[model samples]
Target: MDRLAGTSGFGGVYGAGIARPQRGSSIVIGYESALAFWRRSRVEDPALTRELLAQLYPDDMLATLDAEALAADTSLRPLELPNSPFERIHHAALALGLREPVDIVVGKDAARRRSPSARCHVWSGPVSDGLLVGVEPGVYICSPELIVAQLASELGLYKTISLAMELCGSYSLLVNGACEYGVPSSTSHSRISSVLRLSDSFRGIDVAKQAALYSIDGSASPRETVLAVMLSLPRRLGGWGCGKPLLNAEIMLSAAAARECSRSSLRADLLFDEADLDVEYQGREWHTKPEDRTSDEARQNALMMMGKSCLFISREQISDEARMDGIALLIRSRLGLRPYRRPLSTGMSLRRHQMMLDFGLA
Candidate 1:
């Protein structure tokens, strides 16, 4: 009798003392059961499947199957399944042009059966349909709102807020009656607010709610989101406590003026309308090109010609805590606000410190 094939894409057969099939076609039992088992286990990526099996199973058992020969034979493989929630979110974030790291929530049943690993985290809490997005058959992921909630539960307040800001600042809302990927609308703030209200009973909902206040839509990058949060967070929590600033605030230009300035419009990364202060984050990755640098200089000059004060924060400046403090002090001094008190030392909480590192504040 022919032995049953294993469920992995790295084709192989299983069972003890089972003879290889004769010249005729093989009779495979449990084919449907094996497929269902793989799908339920979230073993979607073939490459990841190989890695997991190698890590989890005994070498002698693996050696029994001709993994290399099976890998070369495509017909023996299982059907390719949709990615796990972790991978789905990562791809979704990339599709939506977000740069923040994606966090995931593993169901309790799956977590209980498998050993913890870095590939995905175990979510030891309740889950419901409202929190998930079913993208394909047997594939599930957290919706954007639930993603924020999971981050809040796992990463704490500051990092969660920072991630929420990144999401709102970079991506538009996912509403119906639009394209498959959805249209770019300025509904991130409102959508997040609604999510907070709906998820009020979820774990870590309080922190998620508080974090929503600091998030603004229309941010262009992760760094820009962090910069906005740093400036707007209250000083009591070691932030600059500056009033909320508009992100990517537009400066309109007439055709003639635009032609003369060599641009159509100016969108300040962070704009304080009351103080007329424009804070820009210039990362080396995007600003290293000579043309990019020249264009930036010209844009700054144009803003200056319009009587706007501009502050350019480089990657270096923001990476250093002392330099960021100085920048905050300069802004406060210019706005005629009270003297900048040295940002209170981040309290002696290990979790807070980890959060700071995660959000790149450290």
Candidate 2:
């Protein structure tokens, strides 16, 4: 429910509910044009970089970018493109030991499965990190960590869309289910597939003028309702989610909703103890317990360090140490900085891991 815009923590519920501004309207997030201006500046002035960060990140995130630290590290230069602002931040973070460098490939199926999934073939390498800088209106330095986080945050937004769609679709389906013989019949379930297909087809057509008529039809059958729900998704998500498959969006939405749903269900003794969620980076695994000193000030500090604007706390208030660990864990997880290990039970040693594995083990 908390919509923290520009903050590194939470991207908020459903991406500010803002329409994906038209293609040429302002500037798209992942397009090449977004960082085109960076090619012009040889030194890439610090002030210019700071301004770009201001435009791309929330004001609360400025300190974490470590403008001063970046300026001091003269070896760093503007990252090459064909990437995104989020990617650039990720590289910088890796270099700064803020996160692990991960190899992100966009393929038909990232996991090599039949389904269309954004495959994340994480390679272990030195943690890399970078700052977000705006080169021009359409261009900005790519922060890989931020981009991953942004994508992760989308899971929540997509959930809202799906649930809303499901509720509406289910309501109409219930009616259609009962339309048979004046009583609900199991045969109505078969209509779901037909409706899904119809919805997919409808996406290609314009139904602006037929809204009312379609609404009436949709109420007649669960299939029509399901189709209506699918058809309505593009409007909320802003044009079919790029190259990603429909199922990927479904999964992302489900994950986000699941996390939010579990927030209040966490046990009092359970702090930041998730193994996958609480990770190790740069040879150190951040502590899993919440900081002992709990207070609003500690929570704010943790949020600041973690670059997150949202918090899902347990019965005991979060402390500074807990916040710090949370931030480190988040950075590591987002950047893929943690040790790349096969499941411990699998019995694979680090030496057997790929070369890239050792490179990222630190």
Candidate 3:
């Protein structure tokens, strides 16, 4: 495993990219104004310092983080924050200190490949057999899987993949209380996590057929259908939407709705409580919250509307008549769309639930 470039706020290495000050450079020291306040508190934690700065500034203070201090601080370690998903599994391994066989490979082939020298597969993609991290052998604060999940959530998407492979040492780095040689006793063939499916249905198809397949009533998830429709088009054509096809079409549709909401001067209090919120959209004082309804009904309506719109856009270029024909066509196409409603019948709900109490959702 090779050492990656820089790691200031991510992974383990912190200060690799900072530039040193020259001897002739002017050094501005305002000890009376700046040092006096810091000395009164003398805080060491980066997150605490960031919190204080955000509190004091209350406006664009995120740029003030000192990468130099962040890297050199011994008390701090990689992925220490609760908000991050990276677990302290390596720390547990290091504590074990067993000399295990470490095998690193590039792709799925290398991951699944069986060889005498192999112990782990350094798969470059987001899929992780157990825990995944950097290609380098040293301490990593975050894994690629965690990073990908964060990116997907921020982008309001479900999944994303990478091409680069990292160090995938075979065997769990920790065995019981010590680092053992070769694969960890716990790692077994039964521990396989992800599997790929291949089929002939993914072959060449024209726009109409592609649209028809995706438009078939309730056969797949709205996001799935949208992604299928997007992938069916050429790269250039697909570029019109978000970069990742796995992202829900709602991201685009919601943006349009947001624009409409903004134009209509909606109000925050009408939709959500504004007690602790620090930000609000401009000219949004005229909006009306949707009437309270059963969750199932609301979800069904949303899915129907989203699916209908996505299929309409996918099948042909948008038209005024297409909008008007929705009701009549919906009745006639009820049978075709029957498959899409199966998930609802199974009693599964799509709304996301917050995991921890600290996130504020609880």
Candidate 4:
């Protein structure tokens, strides 16, 4: 392939009356060079190569080359070929050693191309260099900011921000083994802002901006982030519109109080200080353990005794619309907000409806 750039083009090499090899004979002399060239280039497919060869060469000309011998050539090693950007991103993430699973662009055609063992959830949007980080050669993955923006596009303003908070922590699912991805906690906010700036003209940029406005830097888990967003998002966006709350806010305890509680301090997942509200999200994975359940119950009781009203949002409740609506109403009532009145006709745009559904607003 490289030699094609020289004065002796493919035509020049063959037009010089070069002798043809036997039909079933191996052409091993330049096999390594050809294999190296193919590996360094794009993906390889024997069928596609044959089709192209048939187009470029006469049938008799192609018949002289041994297809079986070419295919069985040990000089050509197998190379990994990713079928889509998602696969490329997965490989790149592994190469870069990212701590959390980053979101990838999955356009309208994704359903047709989806595989059973896909690693990342797809986002429907335009993907460009602005959204990807190239790690190893030919491996491109979404950058942290791009990941946040993509999440915003799919998950809406509130949830995306909350996700950013969770991703900002040291521990993320993307990292390998016991070690966590060592991302700086403070970088989450700034990176989101930077991404917003770069993606000013991008589709769904408005939603990304809105999510960034509510994103805080400290969320221990995805459930916690969702709970915070649900509590703080405005009613117009299909949320209760409660005031923004501190996330993972610590409650100091006296030595005697600590002894009684068997801990020196407690951190509320979401805390509305003025309203004296403490919200905790108990995902089935963590809260199912007996020890965790017991500790959580004790913590709730302690918080209640301290004049703080506690709301425990379960994983099931989060998934159920009726329960979520009830929770929303309860939060509004506690925050002294008026009862939510659904519009007679929402007149909602298709984009808005999609965004609402993506953010769990619906």
Winning candidate number (lDDT):
1
Task: Work out the TM-score per prediction.
Answer: 0.57, 0.20, 0.20, 0.53
Better of 2 and 3 by lDDT: 2
lDDT winner, 1 or 3: 1
Sliding window of 10 residues with minimal summed lDDT for model 2? 240-249
The most accurate candidate by TM-score is: 1
* Over 4 Å off, model 4: 1-143, 150-159, 170-186, 194-199, 285-288, 341-362
lDDT of 4 at 264: 76
| Local error of candidate 1 at residue 298 (angstroms) | 1.6
Candidate 1 yields a Cα-based lDDT of 0.51
Query: Model 3: per-residue lDDT, tens digit, 1-362?
Result: 11122322322222232222222211111111112222221122334322222211111111232333223321222212122112222332333231222222223342243333223332232222112222112322122212222232222221111100000111111223232222211111111111111111211212212222222111112222232322222222321111112212122224444343233222221011111111111122212333322322333334334342212221222112234134223322432322222222111212111111111122
Q: Least lDDT summed over 10 consecutive residues: which range in candidate 4? A: 26-35
RMSD in angstroms, all models?
Answer: 17.5, 24.5, 20.5, 18.9
Q: Write the per-residue lDDT of candidate 4 for residues 100-213, one digit (tens) a residue.
A: 233323333433234332323334332322223223454433444555665465565655665567555433432112222332332355445644653355456787887777
- Collision pairs in model 4: 99-174, 99-175, 100-174
Writing each residue's lDDT as its tens digit, candidate 1 over 201-303 gives: 5567788787777677677666776777777777655467676889889986556546646988888888887777789898877665888777777777777
- Superposed model 2: Cα runs more than 4 Å off: 1-23, 27-43, 59-134, 137-144, 148-352, 355-362
Which model is ahead, 3 or 4, in terms of lDDT?
A: 4
Native-to-model Cα distance after best TM-score fit, residue 264 in candidate 2, in Å:
48
Q: Alpha carbon lDDT of residue 75, candidate 2?
A: 21
